[model samples]
Target: MDKLTVPTMAELAAKGESPEILFWVGCAGSFDERAQKITRDICKILQHVGIKFAVLGTEESCTGDPAKRAGNEFLFQMQAMSNIQVLDGYNIKKIVTGCPHCFNTLRNEYPGLGGNYEVIHHSQLIQQLIDESKLKAEGGESFKGKKITFHDPCYLGRANNVYEAPRKALEILDADLVEMKRCKSNGLCCGAGGAQMFKEPEKGKKDINIERIDEALALNPNIVASSCPFCMTMLSDGVKNYNKEQEVKVLDIAEITARANGL
Candidate 1:
């Protein structure tokens, strides 16, 4: 991957000439090409609707969510502190993140490091945009014949109580929604959370994500939509590894939203 280039929150604040919002593109969004595209699309939607926001790219650094989940509290603290210093220098008071893990960490964990800021997941912001008439579903396209299911990321649903925004986004797409047996607050883990993204999964009866994918597939949905990049990556891999990729597609909520918006 190319080296990440991002402005300090302060620099972005100065460039915009008015303090408004900063978009925190997490490590996955920064490193993964597909995730980056979704992040850009979200930013475009927000910007087109008159929401002033700046992208904090690689400069935003890792929120150390994986480190914290991996039992490396010291490393987590160090990373959190470094991020706090950067945000403080920029005098940033609010942030929007594309990745759910980063969203959970910034919103729930940063205060412990003496960093307090209003943080929002992209889903929340997008929902706001829709409500304010800043975004609207394009009229001509619809997935009338397609059936889809949503996989709630633990960090987004259980961790942050964000269970509606992505669904609302999908609803606008006009897809036939199928509820998983284990969804929402009782949702199954993708086995990629708690820094499981950084390490190999422990040997178990079955891969947690594979099990989750199997559940989604049993419903015979055309797509598996989720809000987290990690979920997208893991679920997509599970489908491919299990030789079921042809039967289902994995997409980020932003990607689905963009499609619905005709972007």
Candidate 2:
């Protein structure tokens, strides 16, 4: 896929312009190759919809989710303050993020520290664009009748009560969207939450991700969909552990929307 050339806030500000939304590319979106693809796909969507969006680029930092989760309040505050300074400098109000971890921190946790903004997950932005008719299946209907099951990210679903935005975006694909036994408010984690992704898991009879994947496999989904990049990693690892990589695909919601829209 050709890469989309996304602009930075500084570049926009140099021209005395401001974007409608600031695209907050979290740590994974910046450093992880797999997540980077999702970032590009989301950029394609924003470009396709003609939405003026900008990133912080080198100025963006971690949302301190891992630090706070790892019991490092001091570090979390340090990181948050730095980011808040940069954002406030730009007078940014609306922000969109592809990672639910960032979404959770920015929307729910940043206010107390004087960092307040209307933060939205990428899925929510995509759903809004589709609803407003800014985006559509121009080439053809993609994933029509294909079996798909969504694995809700803990941060995006239960934490923020954003269960419908993702599903609403998938509904545009016209796919056979299925739900796991545990979904929405009762969703299961992929074992990487609470800073677990950075360390080895303690002994458990069954891995959380494997357990979640088992439920997805039972549904025989053609694609196991995810919204968060961390969930994408855990679920893909789970599928590969079961030697089902070829049979099932683990994709981000942004990737699916981009492909469906022929971006």
Candidate 3:
């Protein structure tokens, strides 16, 4: 991976003269091309509706979630302090992050480390935009051709109580939506959260995500959509490993919305 370094929030504030919003694209979304595209699409939609936001780019470093979860308090404190200094410099009080891990860390954990900000997940912002009529899907061009299901990220759903925005977004697309036997607050981990993204999972009976893929496929859905980049990456790998290509797809909620809007 590239060296993990980020701008202090002050440096970012200096760059944007007067930024209207701080867009926090987490490590996964920043490193993964597909995730980046979805993030860009969301930014476009927000911009179309006059939401002035500044992309933090490489300046928004890891939220230290992996370190903290791994019990490496030293590394976690270093990362957290660096990020706090950056945020303090920028005078940023509000942040929008695409990754639920980042969202949870910033919103819930940061205050203890002297970083306080109002953090909102991308899904929440998208739902708001749609509700205000700033974002709309074209009517009738439903994913009538395929069936799909949504996977709830633990941080976004159980930890933060944000279970409906993403599902609502999918419902608008008119896709054949099915619920996983374990969903919403009861959703299973894709084996990618809680810093699982940075480490190898212990060998087990089966991969958590693969099990999820099987469940989604059991419903015969052509696509499995989710809000978290980590979940998307894991589930996509699960589908590929299972040799379910051509039979199913994995998509981010923003990508689904973009398609529904005919963008």
Candidate 4:
């Protein structure tokens, strides 16, 4: 693989260059070790398809999804305002986020606070790329006969109604795409929403992620695909709890697409 060239928005600004879109590397995508790989694959896809994109780098702050979800509206607004100021300074008009949490807040909540931009989730962006014929998935590793099931993140599905784009991205692989009994608008959360990931379950009969994984495992999928970083972590942990880590793999949509496209 060739070395990846990821430019920071600051670098682009210094050169009087503007990117087609800003890649918002959320908290997980930046700090989480596992999620960093997903971030890189997302970048590789953008680079492979010649999409001029740049990360905010040090200028970027937390989208405050967790803070907002945790009921700290004041902190959330403060973070949002700071981020908005930086984004406005750079004149960013379009943004794509690897995490659904960031995607939701940036697209929906920010507008009320004076930060407006055309925000798209990575899965949506991938579907767009496929539709444009820029990503053929022809020269990459074959998922031709594999069974893959996608776990919808709460923020991406029910909260925002972005259901089809991700499914469409996976459909191109000619793989067996199975749906859980509760999916789409009826999709179950991976137990990580509403800042739940930061706390332990409050004496629940069963863990939500475990139940979700049970639904996916029932399909006997070879791989469990997820679009959100929180879902990835929760689903992965659930898989481990079942001792099925070797039998089933958990991967992000961007990672799957990157591997399938050999990017």
Steric overlap count per candidate: 1, 0, 6, 0
What overall lDDT goes with each candidate model? 0.82, 0.92, 0.80, 0.94
Give the alpha carbon lDDT tens digit for every residue of 1-263 in model 4. Answer: 46899999999999999999999999999999999999999999999999999999988889999999999999999999999999999999999999999999999999999999999999999999999998878778999989999888889999899999899889999999988888998899999999998999899789999999999999999999989999999999999999999999999999999999888
Q: Candidate 1: what lDDT?
A: 0.82
lDDT tens per residue, model 1, 1-263: 12333344556566666447888989888888768777766766665566666765456788989988889999999999999998887777999899889999999899977999999998888888778777777743566768999999999999888999888877766679999999999999898888787778887788888898889989999999998888988898889887987878888777777666656
Model 3 agreement with the true structure over 1-263: per-residue lDDT tens digits: 12223343455466766566788888777878878777766666555566667766666788888888888888888988899887777778889888888999899999998999989998888888788877777732468656889999999999999999988787767668899899988898888887788777898998888888888788888889898988988888988997987888888888777777755
Q: What is the C-alpha lDDT profile of model 2 across 33-126, one tens digit per residue?
A: 9999999989999988888899999999999999999999999999999999999999999999999999999998899999999999999998
Q: Evaluated with TM-score, which candidate comes out highest?
A: 4
- Angstrom error of the Cα, residue 235, model 2: value is 0.2
Comparison by lDDT, 2 against 4, better one: 4
Which scores higher on TM-score, 1 or 2? 2
Clashing pairs in 4: none
TM-score sort, best first: 4, 2, 1, 3
Q: How close is candidate 4 to the true structure, as a TM-score?
A: 0.98
lDDT of 3 at 222: 88
- Distance (Å) between predicted and true CA of 215, model 1? 0.4
Q: What ranges in model 4 sit over 4 Å off?
A: none
Residue-level error in angstroms, candidate 2, position 86: 0.4
